[model samples]
Target: MTNYGDLVGGDRVHASLYADESVFADELDRIFTRGWVFVGHDSEVAEAGQWVTRRIGREPVIMTRDRDGSVHVLANRCSHRGTALCWEHRGRATSFQCNYHAWTFGLDGSLRAVPYPAGFEKDRVSLGLDRPAQVDSYRGFVFANLDGSAGPLAAHLGRGGVDMIDRLCDLSPTGTIHLAPNWIGHQVHSNWKMWPESDNDGYHLNWVHASMVSSAPDTYYQETVLGGETGNQSLAVDWGDGHVELDFRPSYRRELAWLGVTRERVASYCDALVAARGAEAANRSLWDGPPHGLIFPNLFLGELNLAIIEPTSASTMVHWHTAVQLDGVDEAFNRRILRQSEAAMGPAAFIVPDDAATAERMQLAVDGVQPGWASAADPRGWIDMSRGLGRERTEPDGRKAALISDETTNRGFWRQYRTVMSR
Candidate 1:
């Protein structure tokens, strides 16, 4: 057994945690399988019989809307031969029928029919589809726990997680966000853990993304997180339960800074938002923008974009993301968002590829590293997250926060990771 306690410390973690296959397997079981993970959103399968396929800790699942308008997460495998039932990302289907054996299942995952029913002796109810024991959602964001032992999803989300989701959802004029079905996938040659860290880390923008800053000098990041330690008031905050954020609320010098446009450029969106939420709340939403945070193990609330971290192995993973479109926004406003997402998060976009390259390089440097090299006497095998240890402050709400360049966010992630992985 791995001594996760020793591997993960207050200000550092063993590099082996990123490269070890056994550790990755343990994460799949303890973190992804037993714990709650973001699967998809309710809007993806809004109508009855609509379903989308996803993976919960390597186990394929289908999020479907039943005839009664209830949502379910069913194992995407034929009950007979274990062949995959749905290969497509999404579709509308009254029932899922296996191509090989012709076994049919209802949208609710109940076994409906089997070819040559006379020869089938097993209980139909028992063989419908294996499903996660727990399924829940917050503001249409669906999540599931494969092994029901993880308890309610609310406990997993905590106040911080709930607040983050609410912050994003509240940005929409209708108090809801619509996620497009088209999710672009970027295969990265690094461990999946890199994303939750990279996406939330505020310290690397001046370095890893130096090119983006040099070229797009007036980007919003300049006011939010780009300057030196004392340059911006933006904070790197740790909202426990492994949720971390680079809070840019205080640093915005102007309203709509995040969108890189003024009230006139997006007048229709501004009007709709004001009409729906009133001036005060709408003004706050406009200034604050969407949350730039990570919801524990898998979800990345990337400002105007939503990203899903999919782990394929210890050394390989896929970063899947889509642009978040407001429900009541005009087509032009949404189109603007899509275009920004393409520039920021697309595979060949200005930003993500740089981070991907950094992660890949980090992976190569840490390859085959062992936990034994993490001791105090040897500094080589450890990744230090002690940047803000001395200056970090605790908020009245119990969140730990520090300067934009601090490692507060990194420590927050590792803190929760240690707690979960040790158990």
Candidate 2:
């Protein structure tokens, strides 16, 4: 067995984790298959017979809402000759019929009918298409694990992971978040870990996103509070077993300024949000700010209703910028937020292409390497997660840093990554 502990340290990671194809295959089994991976939000299949097809690890999964309003996730392959049951991204269907062979299945995954009555023996009728080992939901997000022995989704997420997502959904006044109709999906040539690692590493914010910082100079504080020269950012690391949280200090004031908002304009925005969601709920949504972290293997939730990451291989990723409007918000305001998010963070946005370019280049460099590693050393032991290292924070979740260039969160992510992948 490989010593996963040695491969990970407070400051750096083994290059093998990225360069080795065997490692990637092992990760698919150890981490992706064993862990509870997010599929989609419940709102995607709200009506009976509604269904969406997704891939969990390498397995094709079909998620459906049965007639009784219960959600069921099962393999998308037919039992007769092993053909895909659903071809579209999403739709409403009572029964999924295999186009290749006439086999059909119910929404709950039970075999409904098989054409040609004399083709099979009656004794073999009991065998049906396989169901997912387990399917569960937290809030409105759905997840599944191929390993039946794996625990419930809630237990898998633990408290810290659940808290992060709860804060996200709770930000919506209705206690629910809907997927945005507008979305951007891209396939990066880099490994899957790059997305989550970038989220955890705040140091890249000022450098990788320097263009945004420069373009909207007036919007940010002169000091670059979140991604500036002084590096006044702080990090909070919550160790929730398999789940974790890497909270960055609030530094979006400058971005808000670009939107023509200020301390004085807070009330107006709050009022608009309240009118849309309700006073109490709007308050919660406004205060959650932004998060820079991960929900284990996949899932990157960020500020401005941004949720983007990979659902399959390291080469592909989906990005969505969503805003949950209550029953009353102005359509123009929602549209403006959506545009801003896409312009700045969408796949076609200014910085995303550059990031994707770098990821691709990195993949080419490491594609056939025998052994390789990415460096994580910085002055901060656990505290200075920006720019590599700085110092550890005194408090449990606290990590003091002078700028957003710290790597505290990156270390936290890899720490958990090693744990899950090694097992």
Candidate 3:
């Protein structure tokens, strides 16, 4: 048995937790498998037969909607020889068939037919596709869990997390958002935890992303994070249940100085929002637009995009960034959104690569040595996470918040990781 107490300390965790093979294997089973991990956006498979495949935890799974419009998160591996039936990222298909043995399955994963029905002495209808234990969606975001007994999505989201997602969906006048086509993927040579920890972190922006501050467009996000926003509108907030949001509303700008984009654009988007969603809701959005939130486990929303952390190994992981589209917003507004996201989050963009490299570089520092290079007397190495430990304040609305530069969100993550991984 692992002594989780030793791995997770008082606002600090052992360095070995990022490199130990045993810990990595255990995380797949304990945290990812049972938890409600984000699979894909419901909009990705809105139409019948549309599907997308991704890694749910360590296992490959396919998210598809049937002809009847019901969605399923089926294990990607075929039942017969354990072959992956769906290899494409996404496609429109009437059914999935195993190319190796010609085993066919439906969109709902019911095994439809076999090449040789008589080869089985038993009934041919016996074999069928399997769905994850629970699959559900909030707004347009879809999540699945292998644990059948897990709580509903609303329960998992709690108040703060749900509020953050609601803000994201409410950006669209129609109360929906869609996944944009172009997605950027990066295979970072670092521990999976690093990418997620950076999501809700505001401390590293002026330091790690100094280049971004100097070169990138001065947009709503940068202005807020850079301390140009008035009052407490911009904040680092901890949403309960291990979720945290970099809470801030975007400044009104049809065109930003960043990205070298000076053309007047998205001018009437807010007016359209007010017209459709009403002045009260529009004003609320302008005041508290959906902040970039990191859902517990490995899902991220915002920075005008969606990011997923896939744990490939203890020392390596894959991160996916997909630009998101507001359903009722115009092309000009969406174009502006994607342009800003690409300037930093695009595969070749400046910000993402820096973040990815930092994760790997930090992993390289995991030598597991004593502070003074002392003998094996106290060789258990630790990474101090004590920053902002005692400064958290509970908001009247039930969220735990802290200074923008504080580490409250990161600590919230480690504590949750400890609880889930311990069990």
Candidate 4:
């Protein structure tokens, strides 16, 4: 068994944790199964009979809206023969019929009918479908706990997580955000944890994404994260409970800086937000913009996009993402966001591929490292996360913050991983 306490330290982590199959299996059980994992959004199944297939750790599951407009997460396999019920990524189905056995299941996961029912001896109620103990959502973002032993969703998200989601949804004129139906998954030769770290890492932009900065020197990131210490006022915040953010609000030089355009470019979106939320809130949102943060385990609030970290193995994972479309914005404004998302994170995009390459390289470098090498004397297999550690300060609300080019976000994530795995 891996000693999580020894493997994860305040300022470093054992490299083996990233390349160990045993460690990955333990995480699937400890974190993904017993902890809260983001599944899908409510907007995907706005009406009855709509459903989407997803995975909670390694277990395939379905997210559905039943006849009465209730959301449910159930094992995607048929109760009769263990065959998958939904093959497509998403669809509208009043009932799911098994292809092999013809056993029908309701949207609520109830075993409704089976071919040749007279010979079926099992009680339908007892064999409906396996389900997670808990299913909950906040502002349309859904999450599930496979074993159902975790605490309330509110407790898990904490105030920091709540603020991240609130900041994104509040950008919409309706105070709601809609996720595009299409989700593009990017395959990476690295552990799932790399995403929650790299996605929110404030320290790597100047290095890993140098090409983007060199070509698009006028982009918003030039002001948000490119500047060195004292060059920008952006903060790397550790919002406890494993939630972290690269807050660019202070660094933004002008209103609508996050959009990489002036107010004139999105006049209709600005007008709609002003009319719905009033000038003060709308103006503040425009200046502050959406959050660049990670909500622990799986969710990535990637400003204009939302990504879910899907782990396939110790060295393989899928970064599934969808562009965020505001509910009441003009079609053109949403289109602009879509275009930006494609350029930044699409399959062949500039931003994430570089980070993916870096992560893959790191994986290969640490492929067979042993935890025993993470010793004070040798230090052969440890990744340091001590930047700005001594100077990071605690805010009034209890979160920690440092300069944008700091490792506070990485440390925050590893600390939470240690806590969860230790349990």
Ranked by lDDT, the better of candidates 3 and 4 is: 4
Q: Candidate 3's residue-wise lDDT over 71-185, tens digit each?
A: 8889998888899998878888898999999988998888888876776775545566666789998887788888666578788877866777887788778888997885667
Model 3 weakest lDDT span, ten residues long: 250-259
Point out where model 4 deviates above 4 Å: 375-379
Stretches > 4 Å off in candidate 1: 375-380
lDDT of each: 0.91, 0.62, 0.76, 0.91
Off by over 4 Å in 3: 123-126, 227-233, 249-267, 367-379
- Candidate 1 per-residue lDDT, tens place, 1-423, comes to 888998988998889999999999999999998799999989999899888898887899999998888999999998889999999998999899999988999988899998888987889999989999999999999999999988898999998899889989888899998886599999999999999999998989989999999997988998888778799999999999999999999999999999999999998888888999899999999999999999988999999899999999999999999988889888888888898899899679999999999999999988889767766575568878899899999999998999989999999999999999988
TM-score of candidate 1 versus the correct structure, residues matched by position: 0.98
- Model 4: per-residue Cα lDDT over 1-423, one tens digit each: 777998999999899999988999999999999999999999999999989999999999999998888899999998877999999999999898999988898888988888788877877899988999999999999999999889999999999999999999999999998887699999999988999999998888889999999987878998888767779999999998999999999989899988889898889889999999999999999999999999988999999899999999999999999999999988888889999999899569989999999999999998999777776585788888999999899989898999988899999999999999999
Instruction: Order the candidates by lDDT, highest first.
Output: 4, 1, 3, 2
Q: Candidate 3, residue 112: CA error in Å?
A: 0.7
